[model samples]
Target: MVAPALILVILVTLWPVAQSFYNSLFDYRLTDPSRSERFTQSNIDLERYATEYFYISRDLEDLSAQAPDDETAQAVNDIQTEIEAFHSELIEMDGLEEQYGEVDEMIASFTAISDRDLKYAEVDNDWAEGYKDFLAASNEELIALSEGAPEEDFSTTAGNVAGTLDTINSAVIESNFIGLSNYSRYLQDARMWQSLLNTFIFTIASVAVELVLGLAIAILINRVFIGRGVVRASVLIPWAIPTAVAAMMWGFLYDGQTGIVAHYFEQFGLINDASVLLSTANGGMFSVIFADVWKTTPYMALLLLAGLQTIPGSLYEAAEVDGAGKWQQFWKVTLPLLKSAILVALLFRTLDAFRVFDLIYVLTGGGPANSTESISIYAYITLFSQQNFGAGSVLSVIVFLCVALISTLFIKFIGSDLFEGRSR
Candidate 1:
């Protein structure tokens, strides 16, 4: 019965997470200057190792110059022998890569992909050509070294030669793709953590304001009163507004010179001469939270109202009969009865707050300098803006896990009947 949604959740949520973690290991940025360089970085260590072997081969040439006459030829022979051993080691390393590393394959996969190519490209003919060249060069180097050819015989210098090797290693065409290199690169970046912290601040402040205002309004309307229906309907106006539209409305209101919000706040002495709220960091934060609270509080109120309705009217009557005052009845009876609803409201609002984007975008655009960048916004940036698919995936996967953990914790502590539990 609930299987489809659960399956969909797993597909949409969990599957993406697994994919992101996989990507974070690779340097799979779509827009990086070295789209190929990212792949090179992914295999940096392996490439370095191979180059180290080359350098050692070169150093033996240095040692050859100082050799005594009889042994100089023997030294040449010894260098040849050592070079063969190095080639054997390189082959063993490649075998290990086949069994344990996919640096080359992973790099190829990134280079072979773009907006132009779909997954596992049409013919992969280009990659094949590139692969053949790379392999030939790799084999040529090994052959030359083993043949006791001086390192200077190669077309490129020893230092520059490794870069050519890197180019070959990073040819991660779709067919040859394997390894977790992109994701490892994601962990090394600093901007990701900054965006994460920004998101946390926005979500927490927004949810707190919504919960407090919502509960207050719910209690206000819970009592018997004329025009209560009108009041209740009024409360829903903010919730009824499309989030995008409301975001625009707030954007205008937060405008410095012409905004009514600025005019009124200044008139009331809330600020000295500041005319806009979204320009400053603290102001932008406050504005977004304010807008969020205005839009979502009614939703929180409605959920709490539903819970308020379930409390038998008789419980309040009895509390009054037992000499409990209005505040006493509310504290002793209303709050307890409303626990389930409160939790439900909080869970919904909290999750929504964590994922918030449209409002921040319309209102702040995650600026005056990325101050308001939430995790969701950062994920968007990583995925689309920066085009670092792997890094974006890592951030996205982290968000998924955090949301899942929050939902799970809320259900265990306050929402026991929310996700899976039911009355027997």
Candidate 2:
């Protein structure tokens, strides 16, 4: 039983981390065609090359007609001849002619080329380099020709020639494998460090407040009252709300002009202005922490309340019989007995708060100069928004390390307490 559970845990947790670690060793981005793949050797994206070359050939013929002088027309024709010579040799490689024909047909029909064998072809490293250098020189010369051309049509044709060359240039794939460079670069980045600091501050502050408030509420609701059940259920409503919905709700409440919460805070002098809550650095941090405490405190209370009920009533009776007052009984009997529960509650809340994302994201979007941007939000931007998979995976691995450390510390320091709670 334990073996199956452990295997499942490893598969879910460690497998993704291993994959990310592997990807972080490369320089990969979805936006750049050449560096998009993690290639170990010289390769060609034949689908891209053939399609762009097709356009380049047609554009060069058009450019020769638009040339302002005989000399310029000859120069354009000569460059086209050189490119075609290089391309002819490239297609003559083993099995590439057939692949090129298929790719060109696919391009003509506007079909997506999904076959790897047709899309990419391995080539000699030296030949690939020499070809790329020729294309680069051609591009530079075309740019000069564009600027010096007298006629508007000649200039436009020259500029298009350079751009089409750029598209063809993107077909060459060099090895992007650079192990540990992404990690080293980010370790030196100041913004990354600041985001980590923000995560810690948000986690510590919100969890501390929730612990105190949750304990107080737990103790209050644990007592017998006319509507104790109703009070306990009401207390859980905040925690029951979805995190994203709660964040949007708080966004409105923290708005400057029309928000009741902001207006009251300004009137009470808690803030100098109504708009500052979500618009300033300190204000943004405070708003996120405040909103987190409000939403998660009930969860903490419920955990404590479970532990509180486990303590035997006879212990409190015995303490009272020994002349222990209410305060004395709470300190000597209640607190000592509730230690395990408090530790468990703190561990759970600390881990959850440290990984906070959607709450701060939907509320402030990590704005007001990213004062409230947690490490998770930063990772999300790097991964999806920027499409830099290598750097994004590095950030993700860092978050995983931090979470693992937090878990290790909790288990190392309070393992006995946790075990005791479990036994009870």
- Winning model by TM-score: 2
Superpose all Cα atoms of candidate 2 onto the true structure and report the RMSD in Å to 1 decimal: 4.3
Write down the worst ten-residue block by lDDT for model 2. Answer: 415-424
**Candidate 1 displacement at residue 209 in angstroms:** 2.0
Question: lDDT scores for all predictions?
Answer: 0.65, 0.89
Using Cα atoms with residue i matched to residue i, what is each candidate's TM-score against the true structure? 0.66, 0.80
Candidate 2, residues 1-424, lDDT tens digits: the string is 7899999999998998998888888898999877788776788998888778878888999998888889988988999999988888887887888888988899999999888867898877777888889889999999999998778888887898898897787787767888899999999999899999999999999999999998888887786779867777787788888899999999999999988899999999999999999999999999999999989898898989998999999998998899999999889988888987898788888999988999999999987898999999999999999999989999999999999999999898677766763576
Clashes of each: 20, 0
How does model 1 fare in lDDT? 0.65
- Please provide, for model 1 over 1-424, each residue's C-alpha lDDT reduced to its tens digit, 9 standing for 90 to 100: 9999999999996787676776665557676433422231222233323334445555445434533355444634454464455445444542443522343444445443233212212223343444445445654554444344444533233234334444434433323233554446545666666667777887788788777787888877878888977887887888888888999998888788878887788888886655548777778888888888888888887888878878889988888899999989888998888877788778877888888888887788888778787878878877887777766766777788889988888888773467454655
The ten-residue window of minimal lDDT in model 1 covers 115-124
